[model samples]
Target: MIRRWIAVAVALSLVGCGEDPPASPGRFGEVTSAVVLVNPVINQGSTTSVATGGERSGVEFQAEDLTVATDSTGMALVEDLPTGTVTLDFDPGTYSFQVVREKELYDVVLAYRDGTVQPLFPPVRYPLGGEVVEVEPGESIAEAAASDDTIVLLKEGTYPGNLELRAEGVLIFGAWSPTRGPLSVIEGNVTVLGGGNRMRGVKVTGRLTSNANTFSAAFSDIASATITGNGVTLLRNRFTAGQATVPSSNAVLVDNTGIP
Candidate 1:
């Protein structure tokens, strides 16, 4: 799937955070090269620019999707996040951000004059601008998995046995926390029959199988998994079933354990 990511370029004055103090935390750096959420409240797709420092600063990143994933649901991210590092120069402030694609909280860092980067933790949510579909506890993930161009979030709870995902262009996510609150578990086999299926932040205690469809997962746990198709990408996940050779394709495996 094509990765659609949104980014921001903001001057110091127009940036502010809700539900927290708005003052510039402290002035410590000449340039802060960090990722930030600038003017997240505004819809940037139609608005090309905003006034900053008495000048019209054109919007650098355009939001591709308007539906944003709210809360920690496994809902699809509003935009395709660009991978790798982004550099932003800014003055010291109490800033916070969130990455939509990665579905994780964001941190605002301070850059010192001596080139030291200090990240301010306690991250907050920044909407990627998309429609959010809420999945309550004990809800079936089938509809969310079958949808396209929507964000699906499963509240912290255990789901029923096994899930069959045959849809294309959908993301069903679970709560992502180190504490693992709302610990989510799929008790049965997860079968993917379509292409561009992505899974993250959940534990599949049963077997994971896929046809010759394109699949991707990150930071997930799989018991014993098998694949019959190509275009499978697994990153930073653990598979107890170890590795198996597909008849016709090779998997794009990165930072995954017990998979060859």
Candidate 2:
């Protein structure tokens, strides 16, 4: 009996020494961290180039109860963010900004909080042009365009899965010739992370996010569009459902037909 009591005591001690039980992740899943990069007020207008000054400071970052201020480098290391907390509110004294949580890092962009759209990702600078690659339906859009290839021409067919634009200045067109059939279809959500990208003559059946800078789409059909980039223009495009958000003063929606 004494040995059993000792054993119970030892077990209890071990339980106490062990790390506290992990907090429940809730419906959003495990908590994560993202590095938030912010540009200066002058650089905010240009996603591709940095202005005379470095990254700006004094930006307010808030998620839940956690609040942080950007350091001298205009960057904030935001931690303990729920995976479901895809968007965080940021306010620079001069302009309102939105911080989007990417898979690995956070992207900071100028946005107005009108309670219209959700946040997404940001871009890395790539060259303005690259070789064109032809992609068939059912082929991987991510794989069809290599790092060096920028233009992705989709033949008349459906591309599946969550599509991404990783290369800068990429053009994903439906490849319509004089003999036009149906528009090429992307049967998944698209997350754009490259700067100066364009999409034309395609049908996106899922939500579309232009997270990079200077994204333009023309004559395409999108279910929904979340424009997070600067200088984003949606022209002559049609939307089937959901809402279209143009929070940036630089973003333009021209002659677009949409049910939503």
Candidate 3:
């Protein structure tokens, strides 16, 4: 009920000046007495074999009775919040978060909706002997994969075109923003024909199709995924399209949120 009023007040603020000034959230208390900064982020390690990640951009949530939104840097400043034990409610459709009090401040941590923090798992690191291939946005991921390198690192940017991996045992790691979502986004479809491949911290805006080669993805986002390989694994992933096809007898899915 409180959030609904806040929404209506916010809507009124956007109207042209002919309307009366909207009521402030400060009606609940002194809006200037206590100002707090909130950082809403997606913390990694909520799923299997995922890394401790970074902050998101442009997120919105509620601080006490007032609705606040974060900027592109994923930080918001809220004034007039009651000093003690303020309750925060996040949008349940997008993420699961919990508020942990420290001194007079609060730390928002991502977890299950039940307030259960899942155990953290160390992310996959680059191998010692394998060649490391680095690619910037607009560069060819396919070319990097063609090098048959052990690791392909995508810097923070968008890559265009489809990606097909035929190399065996390759690991693709992308620059990721935990709370803001994927930093490295692939604009086209991804086809994996290679065996024993792993991908982490990336977002594929297009569909993903994998053949008989075993594949695993952690902490990533895909529009849709189709796996025909045995022993495939998907952990802590978000499928925006809510479509996934995996052989139940051979695939493992854990702690993922999206359309079923």
Candidate 4:
């Protein structure tokens, strides 16, 4: 019985001394990060050029509360991210990308990613002679009206200075600019197509059409044309009635109220 016990003890010690099998590598957890790249195309009226590669401007990455990340080679590293679908926010632009991992590269082509990530530079839409020009927010419809070759199709938004439709054809306004700041003032025959457009400190000297919509102007003066809209305000300007028609919802005041 003693000899048997000794043998059993020796066997147990040898088992303990044997090296344990190597641990399996841990599974790669879900990791992701948001990345934004700049668009390369430059508009006709734009004064600056678009950036590319590492020199691209307006590129950014946002994950949770952090907005910065590192881009090495062709891949951007968003380390230690939880496993899930990650979104990348960028400016109103286009980009081409390649994912690089362990010396392997994968091409990534994205058309557009919409989010709160505002573009550093505003996008502009130049008229191709007679094409319909949609003025987006943060965009400007400058020199289009002055061009004798192009017919300016103005959308809903505030414009800077007095808009002049010097040509013979019709020039439409009310297209919304992205910024929607007070600098958007109209000085031409602006047709209000939709509601909820804010026009502050604007001076109109041409025909104004409501088109079953509302227009808000802090201070405006109507001269030699008809004003047809619901909400038209003449807060501080003099209205020399030529063919001015005020709609029910349109309000025409004679003093500065507040920011619209």
Best by lDDT: 3
What's the TM-score of every candidate structure?
Answer: 0.50, 0.47, 0.52, 0.26
For 1-260, candidate 2 gives per-residue lDDT tens digits of: 00111211322432464622111111001124444445423312222332223335765756556887766645555556543434555543332233233222223333222322222224221121345455667888887654633555566777896988887766665743222422688998988888877776778888998778878776577888787767875644677784766544665544356522
Q: Compared with the true structure, what per-residue lDDT tens digits does model 1 show for residues 115-196?
A: 2323322222222233345455566777655655444555456676578877675555555554442155677788877776
After superposition, the stretches of candidate 4 with alpha carbons farther than 4 Å from their true spots are 1-139, 142-187, 224-234, 248-260
Q: Order of all candidates by lDDT, from best down to worst?
A: 3, 2, 1, 4
Across residues 1-260, which tens digit of lDDT does each residue of candidate 4 receive?
Answer: 00111211322332464722111111011122222323323212222322322333334655444564333312233333333333444443323222222111111212223432323232111111233233433344544444333323233344444343343332232322212312223545655444433332234556655543334442234443343455443322334444444433324332222111
Rate residue 206 of model 1 by lDDT.
Answer: 82
Per-residue lDDT of 105 in model 3: 18
Ranking by TM-score: 3, 1, 2, 4
lDDT of model 4, residue 169: 31
Better of 2 and 4 by lDDT: 2
**Model 4 Cα displacement at 62 (Å)?**
45
- lDDT per residue for candidate 3 within 105-146, as digits (tens), equals 121333222322332322122232345555678888877777
TM-score of structure candidate 4: 0.26
TM-score for candidate 1, please give it: 0.50
Provide the lDDT at 224 for model 3: 89
Q: lDDT scores for all predictions? A: 0.43, 0.52, 0.54, 0.33
